[model samples]
Target: MGVRALMNDLTGSKSDKSECWMSLRAPELFRVMEKIDKEYALVRKDAQKYIEKIDFNKRMLEVVLAEATVAYQEVYKAGPLYARIPGGLPLGGPCMMKLPDTVLFFHRMKLRNDTFLRVNVLHNDMVNMVLRAHLSVYGLHLKGAYDHTTTGQVRGTLVHTPTAGELGIFLEDIKYTIEGRYRFMGDRLVIELIVSTLSIRNMALKYPNATDSDPPVRLLKKNMADFRTGLKTDLDKWVQDYFNGYLIVADLQDIPSLWKLREYDQYKTSKLAAFTDLAVARINKRILDIGGDYIRVPKFKIVAAYGLVINIYDGALRGLDTMYRRSVATTVFKRDNLRYVDAIIGFKDLEVSYRYVVNFPPGPLMPPSLTGVLRMSAKDLTAHLSLGLLMDPEVVELDINFINPPGPDDITIEGAANILMSNFKHILRYEIATIMSNSLMYGVGLLRTLPRCEPFVPGMLRNTTKLGKFNKKKTLSTSSKNSDEARSKESNYTRPQRRHGTTVKMMQDIGTK
Candidate 1:
């Protein structure tokens, strides 16, 4: 009948034999066996899921690894999150975390490298002037040219109300617009991307801004609905709804003259940035979630990033059209998959009249004055780099201008290509570890498969390896052509009798001359 009764019956009727073992032991062996089975069941349930899809999408593991690198860059930039040791500016300053002048150490020091160092935050006095000029150009009259401390807007606001139509704010100075190939939608901003703009807009500008609120975006004080709306997914909808505009007048005049501007700077940026980042991230995630092939994915990311930028310029077009042409943010990269992105949050080259001041020490003498603002060729003129490729652990190794710096004499297309190819070969040989693709793409290694091929294996890498996965820049035509030729079993596609500019040619160049 029951298990225990059955056991006793079977034992029989051997109850005396079973009783002797039980008498010797403190714990029953069956009880231990039952506990072990229960433990294993739980472990099996937990482990089965991970093991089943161990090599599937793989993002769960990659996300962890990738995010750490970003976190490290952030921490490393913020301070020596890695290891901070103190020294002066030249000696170890670049490597050191803190400056001689005291302040809470940042998780990362925003080392803004610009085409021109003077315009970056390396000096404070320059940035202030850039802001003041931006204010004057917009006629926000927010701050006076001579006085750096005045945070109030009094110019035309003194004479009249900033009618709802005045909500005009924009960036006209950024590179994509400045280079003059971009367009502006009359009702709302829509940045048209261009090829030349990839490195400038997507690399330089975005990285500086991305490093957690340094210049602290100053979009507003009280409400951030504007920033949110500006960041909405459907740019077309905003165009339809806000065909008429709204001018946001900060009651800056409400504050006293003695009050400082920096008091509000950090807070103001915090509010606006939260709105922008949330909206951008939301839109990007949605676009990626509805995925297509690799080709379609990057376009969605670029489109989302550009939408924010174009809207900023379009919003401020009311006044910006004066000193600046309507601004635009362009997507670049000959290949669709490789373009750069950043919330073209705004693009006006900021130009300001500035005086650097340092506070003097108190005693027999006070700490002398030191102050300045970031100066640029223009106000709000910035290039931002935000894109999916950036998230890949593959390090970026090229910049547009550097690859082909302008010569005193103009260089032809062929010459430029030669320069680029040389640099590319050099970088490939050394700088790159992961030449990127949709997944964790890597280079060919020296190994091959077992004969049975239970799972296909890697073949050996030659001393001069040519086999590798395509990068974002590689084209479908190139790949298809290669595949077609491979099907034909063609091995002599590349002839090496003599050449002038190829990698093999380079050896020839070096050998002859």
Candidate 2:
């Protein structure tokens, strides 16, 4: 109040015309101007902080853009245009999501190549026997040898044309629709080709147990065969009706008698269903014996895809006693060019042990003794590839270098243990390396010799391509009951369980009918 009164007095004291106008201003106007200045100061402080934050965000965005540019350039420099895609290797494990049948692109898969068909021994004979039994199950008996060769050589040709990415395979005497599904595990691609539907093309002429000697039997056979020949539709439904109504349900009691003459219980099992099942089991057993159940894809193929392939499956390199101990291995390309690509394998965490015997001729208080556990741990081990024009891949050079070289501390034994340990490690290192190389080569050799036409059938009849061989002598000789029983015993056959209960239902329907 004192200051305001003093300021009023001063304005009143001024009598000049210009000074008199200043005295006319109210006190409320000065208060309002002061309030506006205080508000502006608070807002200016907050606005400065916001500007700094904006600058920081701009710098971060620029850095991200620069990194993206470099990544794009490197990918451009990589192999093909497809390789630049997200699923490309070194990082793209299997890259399977891009396509249905294959990872990137799988053009075609043909089973029996006519130009270079490599049919295995006995494939034909097994096929013919199985077909004969299958037809017999449906009461369709073809007279004179049910020779498959007359129609086609059981030549299973799988043709995948450009029109669709479908796989068509001819499994000797039977026809089935196949579908493929795939998955990625670590660095490998596993494709499961499964049967979607079952079908039959060639029909039978005569009903089971029908004899050619009888007039009605001969007439029945002729009429059925002729009727089947004229029909241009799928025979599955017709065969099902024929089997359920006339063949199996009516002759259920006579099954034993009918098969008795055929010697069908080759497996010696009480659960023998039909001669067809027995033949199927025999073929399954044979495949198991030959190690066709599990097929390890040649690692080189994966190597080419990824450029660097890592396999935790130590089995391939386990042939070497020492190499078997420390198991992780990686196959990588050392160099790549238009002429050729150089690949090498690198091993990690390698540890090998050896045993030695030292002889000290009765010196003072000593005798011959054996030393235990002379251990050597390799710091690094590498192998170079030497591939020629062969179906298999091979490693030519193996260099084993230790991170911690062998020291006296490695041996606990007393007398000339150092000398023995040194010699042992030296020989063991190279021996293991050589064995590991050969082991890898052996696996590749199998991949080369074994048919690449399809994945090996994991189980007999379960996942079979049904492609097989034919032989008139074998088929005819094995038809007798005594021969079938003897063969079944030899085969140790097991009846396969149908995945879909379609057959069981069909049988039930037939019984009801």
Candidate 3:
């Protein structure tokens, strides 16, 4: 084939341009080839250095990406958390029971907004009249329209303040029936409600005595029936939105670092380490709220459920002493669980302390009075954790049952008081163990917030393999062996002895060369 045809066949190009170029530059091509061949030896000599530099840059890029992946994972997990409210919280605050200010704030906001939605927007009176009209068509007339008085005792400062207290709502003489069920949506619990009974308060409806046979009454019933599904749907949506938007949401980004320190008292030392001059320069900014004063992340968290639920954190468990002190100072636990215990049973001056040191030696299960302190063992903490998955707490009963009824003078009642005090220790131990186990399980999978997968970076896979227990042990052993070998090599060799003048002469000879 001619050169043009041969070139086309080699490159699979369907153009006459290659043939034209070849004809015009054939001589120049030969000269260029010869020059390139002459310079090839020089280029080859520096190629190894360029290759090594490229490899170093590539490894650095991989490391940066891997670290970015880890940061992303941590930030993601810190965002959304699931909490389950436990069943049967005490009617009155008990010793050691505490809530965070932020938690109480959100809860109050939820209740206030919910009240506004039902009372102002929906108008319960109007809803009751509609129910009355619908029921009249069916020949079912009630004695009175539905209504009740709601009284709530909310003991707390304004929502922004850093104080937590109880909110007790009492509904007296309810005239309407609300049938509701709780269900889980993904990891969240939600309530679905239906108002089942017509009101007993609104008694002046115009069609109070209309029968199903009446055309107007039948038509009213039909319209109400058509909208019943839509009404229920809207109520359910509002409930879910309240939970998702306000109730269960929390900012937990500080938790990992807080847990690492194990207690709030270590915040200053940790902050100093984290925000040293060198660290500040590298990060390009100083951190605010280093003392956690203005931080609004609640140490205690709650989520809606059929029963009370809470997300227990490592910081809270470790910082029990702080909580205990605060509770005492504020008298948050001053309210009695059994109001009649003192007046009726003659039990007086009941005092209890919730302060505890975790992982402390197991010396005594209960301490003597005036030294009402108990040391919690680490082994006991872990053992109770195994029982977390097994317990599905539906109803919690808190009863200070007497091991033996207080015998007369048995203060004679001081001995009986000690027995009561000893049982309190048992209850405290059970509670602490449950909280610790739940927190540990949260780290693994009870609330696995992030996916378990290695970052898709070049070096990340190697790092993941190194993170394994066996691989870590192997690396440590190899490093120790290599270090030992290095020490032995140093010991085995000796420097040639030289006279001071000879050493000076050798140094002068080297400098001259």
Candidate 3 lDDT, 1-513, residue by residue in tens:
687664444332334121111111212222433343344433323332443444522332233223324453453455421122122321111111112222111111111111211111111111011111011111212121111111113321111222233332221222322322222233332332222223222211223345655433121221121112222233333433433343143222222232322222233223322222222121111011011111111122222222222222212112111100000000000111101000001112221112222222224663333322322222111100000010111111111111111111111112323345443332223333322222222111211111111111122122243324322332322343233234334334322221112211211221111
Q: Assess the local accuracy of residue 508 in candidate 3 as a C-alpha lDDT between 0 and 100.
A: 20
Candidate 2 lDDT: 0.24
Tens-digit lDDT string for candidate 2 (323-371): 2112111111122210111122233333333333433334565434534
| TM-scores of all candidate predictions against the true structure | 0.16, 0.16, 0.16
Candidate 3, lDDT over the whole model: 0.22
TM-score for candidate 2, residues paired by index: 0.16
Q: Please state the error at residue 192 of candidate 2 in Å.
A: 39
Regions more than 4 Å wrong, model 1: 1-259, 292-427, 430-513
Query: Model 1 misses residue 145 by how many Å?
Result: 44
> In candidate 3, residue 257 scores what lDDT?
34
Task: Name the lDDT of candidate 1.
Answer: 0.20
lDDT on C-alpha atoms for all candidate structures: 0.20, 0.24, 0.22
